[model samples]
Target: MIFLRNILFYPAFYLGSVFFVLASVVSIPIGPAPLRWSVAAWSRFHRTCLRWLLGIKIEVEGQLSREPVFYAVRHESFFEAIDAPAMYDTPVTFAKHELSIIPGWGRAAKAYGMIFVERDQGAKALRKMVSAAREYSQEGRPLVIYPEGTRTPHGEAGKLQAGFAGLYKLIGLPVVPVAVNSGPMYHRFWKRPGTITYRIGETIPPGLPRAEIEARVIAAINALN
Candidate 1:
């Protein structure tokens, strides 16, 4: 049954994504609000597919802040990335610079307020990221970033990427670390039925020393492990 469902889901999900991407292209010129809404609708559609087709459900713990802040999330799978805008209202998410160049989807992501980072570009990239983050903060949008930089396998706790600490300090917003155990269930081609939980940890205020803040974020985001 699971195998059959997975087979059905792959085509439906991809085809639905293409439709959403095309819809985003038409909405892009209208501005960020429309683009963001279209993306959120896509995320919700994905959630529905996960629930009905795969028997996978999402359970979020703790409160999401009303004020704008930074969210450093565990990178377990692509599930969290697509689900983010649905989790937070019009969040400013970070994606690789390469993804931002991917024709139609890339242009829509830019219009929808995603920040692309070129890790190899060093200080210059950090400057651009900070500038964009500040602009989003002013607009009352939370910034979501994957601190580990890439997906890690289940049970593995990877080091936070180099740019995270710098971005945290430079952006100067309160940080919320979110721990998610979505890898074991959602990362595979043939997924299992289970609840994927987002365990939101306490918000760490900005301006602590680098070591202290980094330590706090690392511990918090890995809390479930």
Candidate 2:
């Protein structure tokens, strides 16, 4: 039954994605505002599919950050990745460098203000990430980063990436860690049905020692595990 559900979901999700990408492309001449709308709509569409077809639901347990602060989210699966647009109101987000390569979709995502991180580029990439995040911060927008850098298994924790600390220190905003347990439900090839809870952890003030902030973030984002 789960396999059958996944079979149904794959086409629906991809088709919906293609529809939104085309909508974004057509809206290009008008400007990026419409692209943002398209992305939001696509996220809603995904949520609907997750609930109805896959019997999965999302539960965010804490208040979202309304101020211009940085959010450090747990990376357990692609579930939270697509849920970001719905999780917060047009917050600035970061993605892996590779996603920026996909032809049409990548262009639209870039226009949507996603900061693609090149994990291997060292200090150069960190500088670019900080610069882009600062501009968003100046605009009173919340920024989100996956502190773990990559997705780990459901019950395990990963080390906080250097870029997470680098951006937090330079962007000069309080960090709010968000923990989610979605791996057991949605991390595999055939996603299971269950609730994915997003718990907003305590906020850490800016300018703390590197070790302290990193330790706090690691503990907070893995709170669900």
Error of 2 at 144 (Å): 0.9
Give the CA lDDT, 0 to 100, for residue 87 in model 2. Answer: 84
Off by over 4 Å in 2: none
Worst 10 residues of 1 by lDDT: 28-37
lDDT of 1 by residue, 1-225 (tens): 989889888888889999999999999888766777789999999998899988999999999999999999998889989899789988999999899888799988988889998888889989999999999999899999999999988788888887898998899999999999999888988987899999999999998888898888889888777
lDDT of candidate 2 over 1-225, digit per residue (tens): 898889999999998899999998788778878877998898999999999889899898888877888899999899888989888878789999899899788888888888998878888988888889889788877898888888989889898877677787788899999999999999999999999999998888999989999999889889999
Candidate 1 at 8: error in angstroms?
A: 1.2
- In candidate 2, the residue pairs with backbone N, CA or C atoms under 3 Å apart (3 or more residues apart, or in different chains) clash, namely none
- TM-score top scorer: 1
